[model samples]
Target chain A: MKTSEDKLNEALRSALKRKFDDFGDQPNPSSYDLIRARLKQPRNYKYLLLTIALIAFFVAGVMIDQHWITTKSDVLSTKTGIKSVMQKAANLDINQAATTKNQLEENDSVKQSVSEPRTIVSSTSTKISMSSVVPALSPATLPTEQTNIVDAPEILEQAEIAALPVQISSISALQPESFKTTGLNLPAITITEALKSEPAIHTNSQKISWLLNLASLKTYQILTVPKSGDRNFQNFKFPSTFALESLGYKVSIGAEKNGFQMMLHYSTFRQRYSYEIAGDEYVVQAVGQADYKIVRPGTIMNEDNKFELLGIGLSKEVQWGGSPPRRSPQRRSPVRRSPLRQYYASAGVQYSHTLNAGPDIGWINAGFGRQFAINRTVLLNVGPYAEFSPLRLSGKGDPFFYQPYRVGISLGMKLVRP
Target chain B: MKFFTSNKYKDLTQLVRACQKHDPAAQTVFYDRYKSKLTGVCLRYAKTRAEADDIFQEAFIRIFNHINDLKEPEAADSWVKVTVIRTAINYYHRTTKEQELHSSLDYTELQLDSGDYEKMMDQLNVEELLSMINELPDKYRTVINLHLIDGYTHVEIGEMLTMSVATARSQFMRGRNMLLKKLEKKGIVHHENF
Candidate 1:
């Protein structure tokens, strides 16, 4: 204790304590007022995360929807010959039809057909006037001509002009024997050409062309366990009634032609509930193997979780009413907007493998909805949908079983028709 | 200088209880009681007064937010002190500006002298001593303050600064010798034996 080293340590400690024990003085009251102000602010991160996710998904949905609509429409107009049909229809004049008819009359078979009772209805008609064309055709020479046309392969080149007036099956009925001698089996091509030549028929057949729908729904999830008495599935039981969950959103793009559509959609749901799990570690195999440990046995877990599901589906929709006629600039009266309405029923399979160790769900969902047009291209769609999980694949030997049944009403917007 | 004895909430436990309830009056009194001591701790770790104020503000905010988790109210003084020190260290870790300053310092051995560092300590005023400490690189100054002034062991310093225990000890020795050298340059301590 009396050593110089000991004395030096004591002296240094005392010096430091003397200088900084109380320091010079307390800060001014105004200086620490800032801390007090900061303490009053509150932070709730759960709501913040939910808000950010919702906004991000909405923006992404809109951007993707816009992109697909633009790209699909552009492809339809350019590569599909629909552009040629529209151009030919818009440029339809009596002089052009006469020139085309005169061109056809140059053939020896066409001159013979003109001498017969056979009538060549001009392609100038916007509608598919097959009824008018059929009545003027000679029924006697049709079968014999069809047999000749079937044998001659070179005649298919002129199938477009030949099939213009009649139904595809009656291709030979409109032609003379000389034209039918160069036979070709081109029924599919003949049908397509028949539709294309008549722009009005083509436009009407392709109605309700493409639609983009954004939906918001209040969901109810029913959790149930299978009756199969497997010891590995004993931890969960079925709920007899539905529990109302939070709202979710869905964005879908469907391409419809001739009242049938193929739809691809993405939807998100937030499930919030409490359930008891037998506390133990278990391995279950779903899309891949997974290891999970539910905290101690008999522990009740409260969850508020969000997951996404991607699905592809096919649907049949029946539509009535037509888009309103464009108002002429000469008519000053306000044009009343009448929107087309359609009803559709769809069935689809949805799968989600990413739930952070939760069971993967494979659901078969059936939905029906009605669309009311908001304008020429946009519509409001509202409907009810139900999803049932026939298969719940878990990691191997997983004790927890989840059979999710979801029923909800969705209100959405449909954008753009072809 | 103001002392804690002048505050209305003289008992540490009573002050902590009222602060936990988020009472404005109790919070103000609690801050007044610990401001000088904690700010002094922050100043030793920080390079400047503005930096010290920032650390102090952040530390107090954390203290109030987590004060509800404290089981013993009487220990609020030591708890608040620990929080401030940890906050200052974290602040430095976040900034990472000390790497440049630490790299510039020369750690070459100086002339060995068993000078009377205790006698040098007596001549220097608090401001002069703190000024000399602040002049040292952040790495060495922090180790010196933690080891000598606060009396934290080398192992504790290593853990707090996320460095090896041997590094902490070396830093403290270098920082101590630097302070003695500063005192000698000031003509306050003459090495008669050297």
Candidate 2:
């Protein structure tokens, strides 16, 4: 009943099984040992990836901090100098009160009532209506305001006050014995101390206020030719180019409420475009070994012209991190410290117009960064960011074209105000 | 063929369980047990002893690495053999540089008598038969080995080789005829039957 094909298959299978089933040959005895050795060896790729991650983190930290680019606002010496100027102004005001008393009584606009003793809360802009008259403080011969409201300190400029001669004396003239009877419980604060205290008081009232953040970006442009059937465009190579002109800058003015910042921004950057030809059909020769090469007769091209762009956008911030603790409304703390740190991510769309002769483009942008508090009112930030654009930028009558996208690091400062 | 049918089967199961945990001593025993059988497989698939050794070692490494994936320890024998065969195929596919040349060969005109082929296979020794199989083109040799000696169905061979079942069957026929021609050239079978 068996056919020749079945018989042939049976014969082959029977012979193969008989030969190979119990077949044994001596292999290199070291094969198992080699396997053991290989298994024992640590995986180098995991370590390599870890090392690369650490190096990248270190480099990004260095780039973000930029310790070499320290601002005057960050220096202790500048703060000390400002404190000294304020101290001298306070001493001058206390010392000159007696000398200027006769001149103060002659001005009809100024009224002094010595009978009813009350707290003297005086400033150039504000006058407290009390049972006793409070004299308005002027830059020439007047004591500064003793109290700082939710608004900033209404004090004379330190430069104007520090220009006068100062004497070391008790500030009892500004804080009279009668001030204690008024029961306001206000401390005898000097102009120097008031300047130090005003920021905390002002920030407490500035929950939802306007914030202006300025940013500078070092842009890297990505260029690609549009997919087309044309052979010339397909064979073109776009090598990346970078220079000082590649640095883009942005200014965002927005308001933040409950950690959400909605901003309208204006950004600007310049692009310098260039490309090279590559194909098997055309013989290629480099022109000075640059990005471009000569492929056809009179087809040599090299462009290093500036294309300045002015862009405007609207963005909203998404912040996620620990925030500063809130203060009770009824109980005010005399001093408030800055929060440890904060982080934010933002996304938006932008439309740009070229200041030079070029095509206008639109971009969708996103960025994330860590914020370092410089003070209660100002924060410094640095982060990696990217922008994507779909518009094609091409030369008129040129066969080659490219769509552009940009990636960059944005360094900026946020200034908060009521 | 039936192998490890009784107490040896229990030992193989225990050995596989130990190997799954990557016990070094058990791995050595497992290696020693399967080495000869898998080597026989590699030798048939490879052209030379050195290539066979390479495939055998790579196959064993894969067997040890993936042993933990074998849910039923009883299937270790078949699993190991399948791993060895697949490793050998992958090794040959990676190293074969003349694939285009082999694919361009004409297999349509090989007219041979199956009766003569069947008669010749009985006289041929295992070494001679293996040599004839090795002499065939890579595609044909692999298809013949997978379908005939390995007891794989044409559908299984097609899936393994990434070809249609029709192609696998046609390739086996051509390879069988080529082997018969070699036997005829050696005077072991007469060509007049064709």
Candidate 3:
């Protein structure tokens, strides 16, 4: 005869087993299902998720602040001073330079600020111009100063401000994201962002200004490249979709004004992909995509895969937001654009040649971004952008190939060259 | 309002997938599948029936919240149990007052003879045995259930309970000793076994 102990143990195991599988659960039923349902509404979940995300963002901001602000170095002090120099430069009316030196001696703040010519030049002349100022000038401020520069050949301390390199270095040291490059130490810069970085230089009537952008980007492409003139191979398909990475800088020197501005910008985007030509359906080629002609389907092999793009773009910016230039209303001066508005949108027509080799492709691109003053010197720029281009890639025997559009985003910091 | 029917999932993987998607019926099924065992786990750690209920509810909530973080769906049973244990510990920490120095305890090992509990098993039910477990101090019960029933090593128990491995082992031994004495006093285990 079996002991009741055996039955008790058996009952416990039986009670714990899940109805469908042997997974354990007691015989007791619970109202947890009903209660959890009441508690787990989608709206509640969304709110909870939103709250958590907000907390995370707050924590991240705090962390970034702590990390960036706590570090003390000569580099930091220079970056800190870049903003003051920009602020003062924008309001400078260097035409007053002859009189400002006299005031500098009387004003303790200005006198205290005095230092050796070399240290002041290296420090105040930021590599990147601070683009923070609204650039809004009363007719009496910048316009009058421009008229006086000719009268007084003793341009005073205006000669102390080194124009282009200072803007580049200052912006590079402050933030590398804005203009994406040409601002601080960046080699490539957005045209409008460059405008903001060195408005101090534009305080004069210059036709051309330097722009740089610094950024790292990666993208992928999938297309069927058509073979040339070989009508039989024209329909050949290569469903080549792979990944590529790029780390490059762009540089632009643009002609500027208060109404309309255009820039000739160039960039080199590099890509890396895996190429295995196992069949005609999947043809692998070099990094710079070279057109392939296939006579047979499923008859190719994979070997080398790498592509470099040398891209050139003609970008345009219209300062429609600027207050119509008061005195130059009929002329539509670019200065009419709201001098206070530091944000702008840009569009461009671009061409890319694969690594000084491969097919030349064209793209039309547009983007919108904003610059916020982080401090007197640093400006944070972030934006979303899209680029459209033709997918003229094809190989032999590929009957079905899909070409998808490409889009990307960029973030950077620039010096607020007031 | 019910959004799904509990019996729809075919397997643990399917159930876990449904839960990850926040499928109402799948979650109900998951709850039905694990609640009883998890409640049993809660009983070992909580100081009272109300506390056990609270721990079970909190543990299930946590499990659902982090279901996607579980690396292996097949290991859901062990993972759920571990989560409940941690939740119970957390509940203890949250509800209890400030902790003081844990005075050293000198409890001898408990030895059983002649199958008294086996005989008592015929008379006393599982709920009664659970109640007997509940009689132990909260710390001891947690240590005992985690080490013996849940099969957590002393190091694991210590880490879970925020104590040293030796402390976890000692608490388990002391809890076991105290539980056996209670069983003897209640005649569930014969007094002569000591």
Candidate 4:
């Protein structure tokens, strides 16, 4: 007694209800659940082992520190004595210069005799003459050596006479005007007392050796010093290339001859339009250039170029804001102490998924992006993007597949700075 | 089903949490809820009930092992649906060539009354609806299944299938119309409504 239409509707509704109920009431195995549960035990065991290892490491570290302190004390004491002796030696040289000047002034006759520059007398004769005049000058004007000199006046005069020729010889060894004023008789004092102050003498030799070692350390060769010509090469582009050019940048390019090279120059606001292409396509011979400079010492900029091979594909050339000029192509180390503007530009094959009708379609994209800090934490990146794919052009059987192209922008950010 | 039988949605969440904590009872409870539904999903792509049962067990095992990869708990139903579909595709790839060799030979022939055909058609549910879909040629079945059952739009199906949106729409409509006619002739559906 149901109408045909009613029966059909009832059938459709019943079919839907039956589908929902078809899930059925039956028990199923939980093998995965069991495995997951079993996995927890091993994970717990791993954590326990890690904890025990860490505690053992910490205890070992404390024990090592205690042992290290005991062994270093002797070395520390020896260094302290050496340092004090060196300080005293330096002070002694200053006193010797003052005493020599006073002795010359007090005896004009002796000065007159010595003035000839050839009156080089024996150590005994010079000592008797200098000691007779020592009391004429104030104690302050005299050298601090007076304390030791008064105890053995004859020994002091003998030491001074013997030391005088050595000092004069060292001074005259200089080019004529090099020791014109304030010439401390340093060589004489340094050599004779060198035996008494062995620690100070050792310290002086060590200081000279340390300086020589520093000088001989492998220095970075001046492959190419930054020059005005480099800046001139960078100024080829206008400040801006497009409507939004105010947001763009101007870049310079220069090459050092250490390696095969090419250069690209462009504005930040414009397409990275310059490139040095050096080789053939089949057995492609080329040196690509993608270098950028920082506008400010520590700021970052978002700019880049897209490097695409005619046959292989596209690649990205990122221009970081703070990169120093490259003196050597092979050396990628940063010269500036602060994190030099970091950027990467690479040219290689790339792929991406695409949606199309008929046969499955995919895209090959070549592009690059720039990453730079807006602040300590946040960074901004932007670059040019291009995509290529094989598809129909117009009719059903076109000879050439449609190779659609798009030039757009890409943006990114760094969550952390390294 | 025992887990869902409690008639409290919160119980499902609690069971999932307990299972995550490695509780055996909770894991068993979680499996009971999804096994039958997953089995039916398996049956649609399988040639027999036994094959369907095997796929059902495999799918559950995979789900349990990879559950930690699921970012949103509430989306578990859709996640399971996609996993089952992917498993069916893998199953089809493995068995199709072997099955094709045997399909050329017929085991036996039997006479069937119109009543029997009608009875079988009457027993059809949504799972059977989906299974009948596999009977369609490859592209049409895939397009229609994606659009109707998986809830993908024509545009999304086009992207997935690498076809235009219009082509996806046309294929889906054609697949549905074919099912409507087949059901109508089997006397399971009355003429006026269809």
Question: Relative to the true structure, how large is the alpha-carbon lDDT of every model?
Answer: 0.55, 0.56, 0.49, 0.39
lDDT of 1 by residue, B1-194 (tens): 24445456767777788888787778778776788778888888888766776788789988988888788997877888889888988887887564543432245443433345555666667777788888877777787788778888989999999889988877776677676567667533433534
Worst 10 residues of 3 chain A by lDDT: A114-123
After the best TM-score superposition of candidate 4, give how far the Cα of residue A284 lies from its true spot, in angstroms.
Answer: 70
Listed in order, the DockQ scores are 0.23, 0.24, 0.07, 0.11
**Backbone-clash count (model 3):** 74
DockQ-based CAPRI category assigned to the predicted complex of candidate 2? acceptable
lDDT per residue as tens, model 4, A96-182: 634644664565465334321111111211211122222222334433432222112222323233223232343334323432334
How big is the positional error of residue B67 in model 3, measured in Å on the Cα after superposition? 0.9
Q: What is the TM-score of chain B alone in each candidate?
A: 0.83, 0.83, 0.81, 0.61
Estimate TM-scores for all models. 0.36, 0.37, 0.34, 0.31
Worst 10 residues of 4 chain A by lDDT: A210-219
Which ranges of candidate 1 are over 4 A from the true structure? Answer: A1-11, A40-418, B1-10, B98-115, B188-194
- Ranked by TM-score, the better of candidates 1 and 4 is 1
Choose the strongest candidate by lDDT: 2
lDDT of 2 by residue, A250-286 (tens): 6666676544556666666655544433333434566
lDDT, model 1: 0.55
The better candidate by DockQ, 2 or 3, is 2
